[model samples]
Target: MSAEQAESEPQADLPGPPPGPAPPSSAPPSSAPPSPMQRAVQNYLRHVTVERGLSTNTVAAYRRDLALYTLWLAGEGIDDPSGVTGNHVGAFVQHLGTREVEPLKASSIARVLSSVRGWHRFLLEEGQTETDVAHETKPPKLGSRLPKAISIEQVEALLDATRGDEVQQLRDCALLELLYATGARVSEAVNLNVDDVIDQEVVRLLGKGGKQRIVPVGSFARAALDAYLVRARPQLSLRGTATPALFLGLRGQRVSRQNAWLIIRAAAARAGLDIEVSPHTLRHSFATHLLAGGADVRVVQELLGHSSVATTQIYTLVTADTLRDMYTSAHPRAR
Candidate 1:
């Protein structure tokens, strides 16, 4: 074979480049034409972003998976949608997980497989391909993970450690209180508008899929929020253009998720807690504590803005584990 042709062949023995940062999206540029495979990938990326309304981070992940898949296809001399087959997709899955260098974890590979399956479906829907080679492909099974939660005592300690008169401290106190009180996701908490807190009795949260729900705020959360709004927010709100966001950073912009995380971590460190605490840790503690206190699962589900009770059911597992631990330690006959 000519050297050029030889270079084009798939190198099963050669490890591909180590996984790198995700490339710029291949969404069809108005200025530059694309190859057939590139056009299909671009269309799918556009579909996920514009039509599906996936978050920027999620869209970036899809872009990364598809870009890697495209590179693998090029090596295999398969440039068009029609050139793909089930065997080819299966091989790609193996390559993603077992590559000598930079092998992906099973969870990561599962995500890549999900992205590939989505892209293939998009190709079939757009009529770019006659067959869906990924129709039968299955994601690798992932181990079940319980939500990480700090004990109620630890949570109380963390909250106490964050108490202060500084504007940022007040904001952090209120933020943490709301997160635990309402089981709000970090994104949901940060995205709150000034008016979302109603009469300081309850707060309206815009959850995933644009769904809104009203959750009653406990007295502590309500008090903290009232203090922040009256004492601290006005000060923090002075630095940037006025926004409707309930929480503001020092720059007066809405607090980013990273900022919320740092606030929680700082509080955890001040409390001298050993566990890694995140905003979601507060949410978990909220649900688990409510469950342990006899709140209904469905009520917790509504409060947490979960679309399905099945998703909310995981907290039951957490409570059960807690019970088992207590039993093991307290009941001598059980031992």
Candidate 2:
């Protein structure tokens, strides 16, 4: 993620930023027929959302990332889906590096590149294009800085900070515990229902790619949910037409993903945590802690509902870090 590597190339067809956010009156030009990449993007977006069953957050990311690719293609005058090449992708990576107007990191570039590759993979499958040029392109070499996971004491402090004798605290406690116990994404957590929590022993999560997995809940998480369901949820629920959602907004409606994130941030802030924490932070910490406690990587992966063990293995990065610390501490020659 070095800035220097990002600043090394200037001669590339750099895509523009997203269509700037504007009021309803300033809608983007739709008068013209869609461009090739635009059409392709629309089709791909539909496939990912409707057929693939990716969550809105994941779909929105594809839109943002793929839009950048489309913009680059438009700028390069490469309208045909059949014309993209490995060189174009490499140039795009360099373009990300050269654009010092705004800071871009190597990790961000890799993510963007990944989206591009995914798009091309789709194209290849559908026969929209014959090339998977993105497949051969190299990602920037990255040393493992490792995923950040706080100590168990920090976790206790984090949850304790959510204390308030009100409906909000109950919701926060449920959300926090569900995240840590089941390792569910914020979207999955918010979309859950009373039925999703099965007798306090396990919860069924609908995860990415429309995959369903049953994950066990710890006693702590179960107790927290029990308290919320008994006290806070009853108070929040209204008479007719109230949602059956396990977690609700102040007015007894199902909470949106954004609101769930807000709840997490508020709790994080209350804990006085200096590092930025998101709902995913809790999930990441959960996976790391579980692995550190000798849970199998595959088991943790299934619990987190990751599509690949490689995604789950990111937690191993934490275990590796702990090993390094042990090495530096215990080995006399190393010191």
Assess every candidate by TM-score: 0.85, 0.81
Clashing pairs in 2: 6-97
- Root-mean-square deviation of candidate 1: 11.6
- Backbone clash count, each prediction separately: 0, 1
**Span of 10 residues, lowest total lDDT, candidate 2:** 1-10
TM-score of 1: 0.85
The deviation in Å at residue 245 for candidate 1 is 1.5
lDDT of 1 by residue, 1-335 (tens): 32122323455797666798867877966886678889888888888878888767678888999999999999999888789999999999999888999999888999899999999988888888888889998877889999888889999999998799988789989999999999999999999999999999999998765678999999999999999999999998898899999999877879888778888887888899998999999999999999999999999998998989999999999999999999999998888
Model 2, 170-263: lDDT tens digits are 8788889888888788888988999999888999888876788998999888988998999898877772256779987766668767777777
Model 2 scores a C-alpha lDDT of: 0.81
Worst 10 contiguous positions by lDDT, candidate 1: 1-10
